[model samples]
Target: MRVKLIESRKVYDGEVSMRLERFSINGRTVDKEIVEHRPSVGIIAVEDDRIFLVSQYRRAADRALLEIPAGKIEEGETPVAAAKREMDEEIGYSGTLKPFLKWYLAPGYDTELMHLFVAKNLHRIPSRREMDDDEDIAVKKVRLDAAVKKCFSGEITDAKTIAAILAYRLKPI
Candidate 1:
């Protein structure tokens, strides 16, 4: 399949955008609208069998979410750098991060790719990174097993969190 972008403009500046595109497949062409989002990084930060997570209200979901540390990949920054930045900003910690997985968060209608990482040997930072003006995050440390259970029990519903937990369990750092 070959896809061409017809037009794109940020629907929500700095967050998401609407994209008009045309796809050619097997001599047939179809036009589709998509959500063009900046790629981001999500980290499964671990220390002594515990996972660092953050809880916050998600306006789009109309509910609070328990999720791993994550943020958009800033321009000219590598995925690992973004992971480190989010970890410090959200959890007030730093660690050694290794690539675990990469996947499209929502491929059918969104262009956001999430780079997942596993952060081990974490240490607390003297000062936490400032949260964004609109963000209020509560940090939580859950045992690895309990975090995994939360995923199966539907308590941890964030896509990146679920995927990262399972991935780390499969191949720990």
Candidate 2:
């Protein structure tokens, strides 16, 4: 299968941008609206039997959601640095980070790739980094086993958080 990019035009720009992409596959032209987004990192911070999570209102979802500490990798920042920084800002912890998984958040129409990490040997930051001005986040601690149950019970609704918990349960890093 051969795919060729015919054209891409930025249609919307803000916190994230939208691109209208026209592609040709095997002489068949197709158009897809892609959401241009920066790569991000999600951290599963574990200590003893507890896993740290954050609950915040997501504008898109129109409600509060329980999610792992996560954020975009800023310009010139590596994914590891983003993971550590997100932990500090969202969960107020620092730890040794290990790469876990990398996957696209919504490949069908989005370009956001999420790098997942397992953060162990945790220590609370004396003065946690301030979260983004528009964000109001509350940290939550859950037992490792219970977190998995929440994933299945629909209590934990974030895709990245569900993926991390299930993956960690299947095989702890």
Model 2 stretches with alpha carbons more than 4 Å out? none
Error of 1 at 111 (Å): 1.3
21-123 per-residue lDDT for model 1 (tens digits) = 6766566777777887889999988889999999988999988899998999988998888888899899999989889889999899988999988888889
- What C-alpha lDDT do the candidate models reach, one value each? 0.87, 0.92
lDDT of 2 by residue, 108-143 (tens): 999999999999999999998878986899999999
What local lDDT score does residue 66 receive in model 1, on the 0 to 100 scale?
99
TM-score of 2: 0.96
Q: How many residue pairs clash in each candidate?
A: 0, 0
Q: Give the TM-scores of the predictions, in the order they appear.
A: 0.90, 0.96
* lDDT of predicted model 1: 0.87
